[model samples]
Target: MRQEFTIWLTGLPSSGKSTLARLVEAKIRDRGFPVMVLDGDEVRTWLTLGLGFSRADREENIRRIAHLAMFQNRSGVATITAAISPYQRARDEARRAIGRFVEVHVSCPIEVCEQRDVKGLYKKARRGEIQGFTGVSDPYEAPLAPEVVVRTDRESKEECVARIMERVEELGYLPRGQVRCEVIVPADLVDELGTNGSSLLAVLASREARLGRAGGPVTAEEWEKIEQRLRALGYLR
Candidate 1:
């Protein structure tokens, strides 16, 4: 990473924010950059230990994370924060504080996120066990015009990370030469490619990545092919 920047991953719980942050951190680390991840769960455990889920507390949590990210960014260190950061104003405040901030909105339907709720957070939220839960009891303000928007429900983690890194370079956060990620395509997917992989890959990396989500614009046949390719590439199970 030639330039210092903060890649802020924001999304509803289980929408893949924390996972993407770690993956991006590893990629930047591979490029010999000093990168650190401030995961929401981890930060809550220590950094903002006493914080609650109240709006004021959440904004304070974001401010504290932003404070650390800002200083790290200034010291040539990259910071990747995987926080729900559900409030728009707080996120905007963080952006103003961190000059090189790159906001990546990881969006997935609540249904999909609930399906991926290994921690059972969504279930608890739905049951009224967790108060002020985002995407259920509490409101989540989606980002407007983030540097990148990822649909994790459709894209595999590898694809999501690649897309994010690509956008990072495109936004002048990371140098062009540092954007490439060595994604290994599976034999099954490679065979399925049969010369059409490049086009499908283009679709995966395209600005239209959001098109194939459930009830999105893609035709059934097109969506099936995309899914097959993604499965072959080990991006889908």
Candidate 2:
């Protein structure tokens, strides 16, 4: 996550790629390095707005992100990309494009990813609201030889970010011994009824526990936002 590094995040949708990328970016920023996360969803709004969900368009989208990463690397900036990027050919194109391409495969089983439907994408895909969805309608080809692989099922976001930072350091992308941390909370809003003051943390805790029971992916940004709201409401010290 330092200079001249390109971390190509490849995984199925909802496999914790963007979440982990944010964590990694935070850690890198804390170290005073310039970093940017090119998330697929946000990138779609700008770069791939003209592209569809078909195989050809998806490949083109990946190509465009890869090109952007390469350009960033040339300018001595680190690029961390979070994209489904399920096709091996597209990933290969990225590796060829970037100078320091570190492919970090974010591995999560389809069933588990479906269960962690924090974005409601799985439900939409199931209901045929979204077509050519990876792992539902289209295929998700795993990386043949990833530079690093993080299994989302067996790891927390902090741990995954640490692994990626370690890999980037190993590839001489970042300085040695960069530590990473993440704080996640289920972003689903829950009515606290009459809860106030110190009770807000408890309420959020209970809600998060229920979300865990319901199989949701808690995110750090959501937790930070909730903490800010709670502080503004005089809920915590």
Candidate 3:
């Protein structure tokens, strides 16, 4: 997106929040927009150093992130925060602080998150090694009404990214160009695919014949075909 806005990524630890944040950052950056990713782990080390896992400290951490995001937005830089941010109040506070905020709830079951845990944090929390750990000792208040919700347990990275971008685009936070259907036959292979009846588009039409496919936006190659047809009839040079 060309406009600077904060994309707040909140979820339980190991719920693929960081992964989704980086994927979104890369996708927006590819669109010629620079995005800043404020990962929770990295922020704790640099920004909110020596912060504990208490509820107060958690709110303070989110406050600090919100403060930074506001400045970034002012300076025309979009921010994506990948934080556990287990409290709803803290997230709401941040949203109010940053007017152009989009909260994305990276959802995954606790069992799934624990299974995907690489740091053995869940095991430690279970054994009382880490005090007030979220999803175990401390409560995780999931967002009741978030801008976007992606279930990492079932959806692939591409699916999750598409879902997030679609919602952001709908909300006018992302550019229209960023939401175009990108998988409509790769540009390089479009010529080889041809206008044959057995092509991918034809196959899709046949498969959805019972449902009756409606006309969609024209692709670059489809426009070229129109131009070629007009030229063949001597409409233009």
Alpha-carbon local distance difference test for all models: 0.76, 0.73, 0.74
Ten-residue region with minimum lDDT total, candidate 1: 205-214
Q: What's the true lDDT of residue 172 in model 2? A: 74
- Candidate 2 C-alpha lDDT tens digits along 108-207: 9888998887878888988999999899889999999999999999998878888888888887777765445332223332234343435433353334
Q: Clashes per prediction?
A: 0, 0, 0
RMSD of 1: 17.3
TM-score against truth, every candidate: 0.73, 0.72, 0.74
Off by over 4 Å in 3: 178-237
Error of 1 at 136 (Å): 0.7
lDDT by residue (tens digit), candidate 3, 118-222 = 999999999999989899999999999998899999999999999988887788777766343222244533553464423332222222222211223334454
Runs off by more than 4 Å, candidate 1: 178-237
Cα displacement (Å) at residue 13, model 1: 0.4
Candidate with top lDDT is: 1
Clashing pairs in 2: none
